[model samples]
Target: MTSIEPITLTGKFVTLEPLSQEHHHGLVDAARDGDLWKLWYTSVPTPEGMAAEIDRRLGLQSQGTMVPFATRSNTTGKLIGMTTYMNIDAETPRLEIGSTWNAASAHGTGTNPDSKLLLLRHAFETLGCPAVEFRTHWMNQQSREAIARLGAKQDGVLRNHSRSKDGALRDTVVFSILEHEWPAVRNGLEFRLAKYSA
Candidate 1:
């Protein structure tokens, strides 16, 4: 089965670098921006857990089931979050883009959209993926909205999808953008970024 490889993806607002131990401290600071770990529905790690999270992602990469990236602000050149291509099915040439979180300060900026643009471009044009999936906890309305803003259609809700760190049942909301839908989504992202550019 073919697998996605770790590679740097750059854009005007953000850059997705292959996740590494070197990004540890920067991510800690980023997580501290909004005390992101306090959000119960998400899995943003605390400062001390940053290294372990990086290790976990790297371990998955080693197993050839995931390709992770540390998101960085192109202007500040600081690590702002993490994202990944996971649940890889090389036979179907599909993957899920999740485990993504950005610093609160980076929210509402062009960072997220630009990052998605770069990722989707790579997944479709480079990786030749037929579909890219996104999943978020149902309680995480903000995340669900963000994914929708990217032009992905909600596939459905997975009830009792998994257990959260807090031991609460999580309803997973699934969204996707098929290969045929990429162009329109790409154009929307471009238009969104252009507004920020000006």
Candidate 2:
């Protein structure tokens, strides 16, 4: 089983740097842009909770369960969001790319797909992961559509999967891209990103 290490993943639109408390101010500003913490379906951190969020993710990393990153806009060179490779099963070399949220301003700017490209490429090509999973609240229609657009196939829905931030019963929509599907998924991501380049 290969252990996940912290490394910088740079892409054309955004760069994913190992998450740190140093990013506190920038992330607070980013979250404020969208008031992301107010989203009932997501777990984005509030300005006051930014440090705790960073600490929580870092603590998980120490437990060998997650590798979190601060997403920065390459063009603006500022922190715009955070993401992670969580629910790791290093023995099977599998992981779920969850706990991701970007500044509302970064939406539709190719940051999400670009970030995915880096993470997926590393997981499949470098880590030899058999599968990469994604899970989202069933009611988060926007997120569901975005995941589907990535070319991942739906595995199934986990009913009453957990509780949302607002304490609502949540159904988790699970999706995955297997090793064999990476080629096509990569192509789709590269194609989407190419448009941004041109």
TM-scores, all models, native as reference: 0.98, 0.98
Backbone clash pairs for candidate 2 read: none
36-155 per-residue lDDT for model 1 (tens digits):
999998999889999999999999999988899999998888888999998888878899999999999999889999988999999999999999999999989999999999999999
Q: What is the C-alpha lDDT of each candidate?
A: 0.92, 0.95
Query: lDDT, candidate 1, residue 85?
Result: 91
What's the TM for model 1?
0.98
**Model 1: residues with Cα > 4 Å off, grouped in runs:** none
Error of 2 at 161 (Å): 1.0
Q: What is the lDDT of residue 146 in candidate 2?
A: 96
After aligning candidate 1 to the native by TM-score, how far in Å is the CA of 27 from where it should be?
0.5
